[model samples]
Target: MGLECIRGASLAPLNTFGIDECAEQLCLVHSDAELREALALADQRGWPVQLLGGGSNLVLAGPVSGLTVVMRSRGRRVVRRNGDSALIEAEAGENWHRLVVWSLDLGLHGLENLSLIPGTVGAAPVQNIGAYGVELCDLFDSLQALDRRTGALCWLNREDCRFAYRDSLFKQQPGRYVILRVRLRLHTRPVPRLDYAPLAAAWQALGLKQPDSRVISRLVCDIRRSKLPDPARLGNAGSFFKNPLVSAEQAAAMLARWPGMPHYPQVDGSVKLAAGWLIEQAGWKGHSRERVGVHREQALVLVNLGGARGGDIMALARDIQQDIERRFGLQLEMEPQLLGN
Candidate 1:
């Protein structure tokens, strides 16, 4: 397909935040050739390019200047299978939750714990997206990405992507590589990960000793729906802040002061502190200012009640960050990518 560009495109419909913003130019690419063509055109025009997937994890500041490329490619297939294990590949544009469901439908099990995560498959690896006790890196096999500078396709292994807690190499150097497709490995044999306390409790409450992948997926979906407001009904980018990782000493200090603070020790000896607890402790839960507010149910989520501007949301987030820092002496980093700078 040839590159098609729309001038002065409204970005509100494209992003999950529903903030009204205009992109100077917008192009939707469905294939590698089309994506390369769009990049070439942007380069020729000296326009900076921004890659957008399912805008589930973004905070648009205002009007976006230059070219905005939306990945719309689609495909999913089991590329290789062996006895109990199989390799699956999905195009960048496929919905993440849909892929999880598709895997379960085919009797695959690894992705059951990651159910209900919003955004496209392409954006998954970029964020190293995780939920429950599973992360994309756990199932990731490899991925194909297009180098914007050289217009070459490169196959990156799991290590090449440099996956970290809610971060990746793609995220480190933004606008350099456009993810085209992702390959993941799944198992036919049931490999339920019911380690997370909430999931384990839900499973136990169901009175089932051995639940299948479908059951686990359904439980995760239900749990997410109960806590998070649907982006369609209420504009939100899910969790707004990354759980801050503190050193052992720092964690000990906070633990001494609060004693009820939820924390998880990492292999590297750092402790991961729950950002939601901090926000709630700082007294921002269910807090609203005009159209933007912190979600009443989930403190991690910032929502647009009705016609909220990006500035309002950003300002509110900054205030929360400042308050949390002041109260706990810990800095919180935002999870969403901020655009239009």
Candidate 2:
């Protein structure tokens, strides 16, 4: 049975940040039937529902109103298979990293490059999650979304989702649909992407000449472990700000001032500036305001050292925002889902 809808449900355990906020109502959905029932209950009670994933990419700013449906839908399976290409589908609640490892165990290649990212499989498409020169869109075959208004399940192909740099159509329409299951197109024939600067640096640093997909996966995980804080130890949303894209002329001007600026040329004739570099340039690295601070190792990540209220973290983010804008003449948008403004 699902957790009965309750008043003042503790939310500290629901978010990675471990903030002491309460949800006005709380419920869990383990299957499609229960999801529909929860939607009906919300409609009848005039209470909005907050759909929670693994709670890895969210900040609970204050006590949330209405019901929360923590997605607990479970299971992962090889939906279809061929000689080299196969369709791997996972329930929304399956741990993302676990699924990645599962695919690798099956000798699947496409997902190996994305190992160890935090959060649920369903949320992957919500932001078209990416890392280490690879992206969810690189393997995303399609997805099934449950429409909130009509309660109808519909399939969305790559074009329908409109995936783009850390964005997708579903992310645009928050609270409007539930991602039920995600399907990925993985390959048995291995091909690894190891051209990212950090990967190459790590390889050169370790005296490695060539690394396959699995080796690249392990290396990427190692690099991420060194930079990012474990959620169990510290409260943080990964990549608090998105890398800002600027015109080539603007990048040249900024390079003149900073000289050692790090960036990549986008296919659309734009330059992707590192948000971490910008934050560091603005002198916010290792900077703290009471409970919240910029992670010294990864300035792009805003961290909760201890008992940080989301508002405090947001204020620091705003400060970072102002500073980056002032310094670089470029604005960086936040990456986390902010609840209870």
Indicate which candidate wins on lDDT.
1
Once fitted onto the true fold, the runs of candidate 1 whose alpha carbons sit more than 4 angstroms away are none
RMSD of 2: 1.7
Pairs clashing in candidate 1? none
| Residue 337 CA displacement from its true place in model 1, Å | 0.4
Off by over 4 Å in 2: 1-3, 203-211
- The C-alpha RMSD of each candidate to the native structure, in angstroms, is 1.1, 1.7
lDDT of each: 0.93, 0.86
For candidate 2, the per-residue lDDT at 299 reads 91
Tens digits of per-residue lDDT for model 1, 1-341:
36789999999998898988899999999888788788889989999999899899999998889999999999999998999899999999999999999999998889998998988999999999999989999999999998877878999999999999999999898988999999999997999899899988998898987768999999999999999999999999999999999999999999999999999999899999999999998889999989999999999999999898889999999999999988999889999999985
TM-scores for the candidates = 0.98, 0.95
Judge candidate 2 at residue 145 and give its lDDT. 87
